[model samples]
Target: MTEKKNAAAIRGPSDHTIRDQIVAAAMEYFSHYGFEKTTVSDLARSIGFSKAYIYKFFGSKQEIGEVICASCLADITERLNAALEKSPSATEKIRQLFQTLAVAGCELFFRERRLYDIAAASSREHWPAAVQYEAALRERVLAILLEGRTAGEFERKTPLDETAMAVYLVLRPLADPLQLQISLDTAGEDANQLAALVLRSLTP
Candidate 1:
């Protein structure tokens, strides 16, 4: 069978319901067990489904982890956007972005350490979800830079793309799952200090 056809067959006719059920069960299982230690078979048994049945929805344990990881990242993005919306200026928005992301990362690390493990694995493995999340974050930073420049609040001599990339890199330690775990103790202070430095650089 073609790859598309194989995927469809594996998903079967009740694709959405079955897929959601599998993902929900996997989230609960991974929360207690962590991602690396649990296998698809273990999740299948926990949910009262056969291994073959679980396979109908997900190809492997990592696939389930990806779904949960994507969900976690999406939640962080939502909170970041909400915080940004409340800011009156581009400078405040940029600061809000860093603070919100740092706070979110710390919350995940301390409260949901197992889910944080899944995120770390996703980053370490270069999963598509992690890659997309990074891309989305970069775009947000670029957009903020453009807004600041257009408003004459930021210097326009430097290339916006380069500035965006630099800003993203500075924020990566607080945003990237693997790095965030290592930086938790100092992430909040680092985020505030970095935001101040970035804002200074941008001043026209």
Candidate 2:
């Protein structure tokens, strides 16, 4: 246990506050720098603590990582809401959804994505808040699609839940920054045409 201190555990001055302080610092570090480069001691140094202080709060680096992952989940939920504020029309809201997703896939949000993917790959059955966060995101988007339907902006015959999920699946891969930059640039030539592909399919 003591060896962990020297190995790279973060230890802070206070027994109670250090843990949360370390976790908060760790969250920002991992979010900005990514998982590969972030170290336990790095987080400790940020909060005026030593490596052992961190281990006292979280048993292992993996444990610390779990907390960061939860933060990422929360971030995704917030990003979607933030994106909605940028637009007024239901049609425009859909575009904002993709734009926000693209931003979320960038360097800023990539750290959380890395953890989300890791948990998904390792524990398919349970991923704690990470999975719930995704489900909640899906629901947010579905609600928007349903709103469009109510306004006669979307296809009326197609079931709102099924169509929203289908569109999410098709657009998920395009959420990548590389794909976004390319598709959005191309989409400019057509004006929401990227969404049109999914929309038409849902309607037809």
Candidate 3:
């Protein structure tokens, strides 16, 4: 009943604009004050909106965080796709994938530390945005493996799904927002070495 009401509240004629404004303001506020420190009331005041009005658009602070997290993850995905497109082969695509993710993770960690915290929280909590990001990333790895096999560049004996899962797991530390922070110092080197190891194993 309450969930239904909230869903209905989020779908009015002005909902899109209002919701985007609230989220945009929340992003800036949270980026400066930190997501953990900012409350709905604080965001409301900063954005010149009543707390109740803000709630009409977002069920909770976490919901707002979800939008911001999704946007950030989308940007990372865009960079990864762009890097892969520039690669000459599936082997190069796999290498670029790891390198792009590592570099993007490090950039976010240092340049947008507070926004990164929201992403870390989303990852830790298994928010829908984070879950979707992981699924898409796995699909990308699976696609790359399939491409390599078809090109006669990789072994076809191993099950593609299993191989993709293994590759995703190998890259998880660098790809995971929380884990990336812990391994920041060595993440780039780790990504390069792991990519090489994975490429060697994938060879026919």
User: Judged by lDDT, which candidate is best?
Assistant: 3
On lDDT, the stronger of 1 and 2 is 1
lDDT of each: 0.85, 0.58, 0.87
Mind giving the per-residue lDDT tens digits that candidate 2 earns over 1-204?
Answer: 011122123433446465667667776676567665767777778778878856666766666665555555456557867778767867778877765665564534334554544333323334444445556657767888877777777777766778778877666554433344444435332334556676566442
Badly placed stretches (over 4 Å) of model 3 are: 1-13
lDDT of 1 by residue, 26-54 (tens): 88888899889999889889989999988
Ranking by lDDT: 3, 1, 2
Worst 10 residues of 2 by lDDT: 1-10
lDDT of 3: 0.87
Q: Please report how far candidate 2 places residue 40 from its true position, in Å.
A: 6.2
TM-score of every candidate relative to the true structure = 0.92, 0.62, 0.92
Badly placed stretches (over 4 Å) of model 2 are 1-16, 24-56, 107-126, 174-193, 202-204
lDDT of 3 by residue, 25-60 (tens): 988998799999999999999989899887776778
Cα TM-score of candidate 2: 0.62
Backbone clash total, candidate 1:
0
Cα lDDT, model 2, residue 42: 78
In angstroms, how far off is 188's CA in candidate 3? 1.3
Candidate 1: which pairs clash? none
Error of 3 at 72 (Å): 0.2
Give the range of the ten consecutive residues with the poorest summed lDDT in model 1: 1-10
